[model samples]
Target: MSAETDLIKLYSQRILALAADIPHLGHLDAPDGSARKRAPLCGSTVTVDLIIADGRISDFAQDVKACALGQAAAAVVGANIIGCTRDQVQTARDQLAAMLKQGGPDPHAPFDGLQVLGPARDYKNRHASILLSLEATLDAFDAATATSASSA
Candidate 1:
């Protein structure tokens, strides 16, 4: 198959629709943690802002400047982030990374949305773009987790 075919597969209808309808597309007014990440190869960027309450994501927002794949990933996170914990998000990030980098299994439930981007693994150049959302989310998690850990 041509490389373009793989690219097309990476941007399926679900991905396109998710990209078109990105949720939580804004900055939070009072976030417990926030982070921004950029994909150098594609020039895509994502900034994540969030608040934690009782160890779960209580509020979330994002400013995403990305292609379909990255936007889709952000959409997935935005769609299911409420009530999620740092460990859940981090595990999903690790699973997604393994899926793209080592041909590992898809992430567990909920995060399985990342399965749609599986085809992009062959295009190493796009890896950063596809991972931007998760990376930014994880970075945001770092701040929330640190303070929560000390205070909890």
Candidate 2:
């Protein structure tokens, strides 16, 4: 298939709609943890802020400035992140990376919507953008936990 056709398939209406309606958008004030990640190839970026309590995310928000694929991924994360544990986010990230890089299956529930990004697998350069939200989220989680550990 042609690159144009691939692009068209990668940016389906569902992805566009998800990109337009990303939930938990924006930043948090004095969040427990925060992180920002950028995709150098496309200059796409995602910044995440989160609060962790009882080992699960209690609040979350993100500032996304990325391509449709990235935004769509962020939308899925935002919509289902409120009560997720770090392990859940890590597994989702790992599964997504595998799907894009290792010909693995789609990520599981709470993040199954990530399947919309499957068409992006051929575009290796776009993979980082697609994973930006989840990466930043994991970084934020690490930051929060590190702080908690230091204070304890």
Candidate 3:
């Protein structure tokens, strides 16, 4: 297939649809933690705000200013993030990275939907944008943990 075809495949109808309907697409008020990350190559940015209770995410929100791939990723995570533990989010992020960078398996269930981005594996420059939402979420989780530690 031609390069144009590859680009078309990367932005399929499903991806566009997901992008159009991202969940939790805003900041939370007085969130327990917040973090922002930018993909320098694409100038894509994602910011995540979350609250943790009993070591699981109790509430989550994100503001995404990125391409369709990034929006789709944020949509998936936001739709499933509630009640998740930090380890679950971290594992999903690591698995998605491996899938994109090392020909590894798709992220486990819940995050397995990220396999829709398989075509993006060949586009190195887009990788960072695609991973932006999860990166911000992880950072937010770390921030929440630190805050709890300091308050203890």
Candidate 3, 1-152: lDDT as tens digits: 99999899999999999899999989999899999999999999999999999999999999999999999988888888899998999999999999999989999977888989888999989899999988999999999999989999
Return whichever of 1 and 2 wins on TM-score: 2
TM-score for every candidate vs. truth? 0.91, 0.97, 0.98
| CA displacement after TM-score superposition, residue 39 of candidate 3 (Å) | 0.6
* RMSD list, candidates in order: 1.8, 0.8, 0.7
lDDT of 2 by residue, 5-117 (tens): 87889889999999999999999998999999999999999999999999999999999999989999999999988999999999999999999999899999999999889
Q: Is candidate 1 or candidate 3 better by lDDT?
A: 3
Better of 1 and 3 by TM-score: 3
Decreasing TM-score order of the candidates? 3, 2, 1
Clashes of each: 0, 0, 0
Local distance difference test, each candidate:
0.87, 0.95, 0.92
Give the runs in model 2 whose Cα sits over 4 Å from its true position.
none
Against the true structure, candidate 3 reaches a TM-score of 0.98
In lDDT terms, which candidate is top?
A: 2
